[model samples]
Target: MRSTGMRARSVPHDSRPVHARPRETEYRPRHPLDLARVVLPQRHGAGDPTMAAANGVIWRASRTPDGPATLALRAGAGGHVRAAAWGPGAEWALDQLPALCGADDDPTGFDAGAHPLVAEAHRRHPDLRIGRTDLVFDALVSAIIEQKVTGMQAFGAWRRIVAWYGERAPGPTPKPMFAPPTIEGWRRVPSWAWHRAGLEPPQSRTIVEAARRGDAIVRAAASAPDADGRERIFTSLRGVGVWTSAETRIRAFGDPDAVSVGDYHLAHHVGFVLTGSRVDDDGMLELLAPWAGQRQRVIRLLYASGIQEPRRGPRMHPEDHRDR
Candidate 1:
């Protein structure tokens, strides 16, 4: 738990070994909600050891100030979200369920009518809202792993590393899931282990560097006055740039205005969706300028539209750089 500052005691990446009665709670959203739009973005990959979705239930393992927590969230009838959590951080997890499911996202004054396509998308996905995990350190680590790589590579690296080093999630989850290691655990990961996990040295080093000041970093970002403040704090770290900062903001705090500026596919997709032609980052930003405060929300609506630039050639294959 956070102390006078944001300092936390030493602990494992997640829950303690002993099992106990899981904490439970229920949240009824003020607006429409769905696991796909909210919790799904937190998954590193389809087979992420940190998350599992089955039988209308979403299971997630996370690290909190108190400790490791495994949360099982199910959307029940009548817009209710029934949740059960296990581990020391269970209460913390339970308390943040509404934010996790987008209850805290305020889209007031956002004009979907700015563009015809955005309006249509907003109409179709009226329940769409940005979700936040509220775990800054965890978000930073994951964002570091994703830098300058194919999604397949990033996802595979995350899956392998978390499964190998992360703590086993508490409770009877649909599938065995793990939470990413504590800040110390992250530093302790051997160099060879990162190579084996398919993460580049630079990315691994960035994570280590960030973890060195993990608690302080979390405090700074969480307490930031606005998206700009978060960006400044995140970019101040070595090897972290706009893309990583934006991704962290989206996952950790659900900043609707944060856009991953250097993302390879984002500019292309945004340009195509808005102008029927792909554009560079500058062009994409220009098209998105109208919705300055809700750029990410507009992007989400674009994604929801299911339009993409056609692929005319073979998909790029993930490169394996491990010692054979």
Candidate 2:
């Protein structure tokens, strides 16, 4: 059993005046079912090895198939989750943790086993777990929100929707957790409402279209082979494409093989990392040639290994379509 405590505080940033409640809980993932051991150390941040820091709103408190297990994140001071949940859909969440952590990844497809880079990554992180949030609705909604917006903008919109429409998870979770939007809730969003959501007409249309056929999409994506299958299905729609589908599959099904195609920055990142300079679609394909079937795994391993290209160009400014 977990414990709770409350304390009030004042904040200058939040305009909505409300009482603050600081909750704390002692989580003991049943022995022999040790979660800390299953917990993949955070490989993408700058921090103490023992603690996982926030990577934005993607981190939130969640429950798993097992009793009250925390998904892909670390608990914060006030008991907030630094990551999102991977609900119980499959054993892949934990069973495939090793591969996700670069432990069992085979990047020979990415090279002739001649490249020492991917091999080194696996050596560094042996227990990394890929998040498995099986809730299709949540993944789809987030994907729609992220269609054409910046990460910050998309996350902000997600926070608003969750705060307004989602429910708190039943447990000792610190931050507010919400269930995915229902079909009815999605249909009720007015055109004006989407404007306030910081979304454009194209993205909004895609979301509505998907929502209307949401059930079909979920079933198809779930039953498909992997990221590639999911992409094939998602792109069949008028609006969904390679990037959106890849993003969805990575978290929705925890498919280790879903690589985002046509990303504004991914090809460049891949190029710099592998060939010491930026690359285009062709170069990226060449670099990832060995890992064609498991390209996504290589990407995940690279991301987890903490190697990055140096920043030089200007950043993508967030477009607040709400103001247009």
lDDT digits (tens) for residues 1-324 of candidate 1: 534453122334443355688888989999988666788988998989989999988899998888889999888888789999998899999999899999889999999999999999999998999999999988988888988888988999888888777778888877777878888888878787789789989999999888889889988988899989998998999889888899999999999998888787788899988888889779988999999999999999999999988986898753422111
What TM-score would each prediction reach against the true structure? Answer: 0.91, 0.66
- Which pairs clash in model 2? 59-82, 59-83, 60-83, 86-132, 101-128, 109-290, 109-291, 110-290, 110-291
Give me the candidate number with maximum lDDT.
Answer: 1
After superposition of all CA atoms, the RMSD between model 2 and the true structure is: 10.0
Candidate 1 has its poorest 10 consecutive residues by lDDT at 2-11
What are the runs in model 2 whose C-alpha is more than 4 Å off?
1-112, 225-228, 318-324
Best by TM-score: 1
Count the clashes in each prediction: 3, 9
- What lDDT is reached at residue 200 by model 1? 89
CA-RMSD of model 1:
6.9
Q: Candidate 1, TM-score vs. the true structure?
A: 0.91
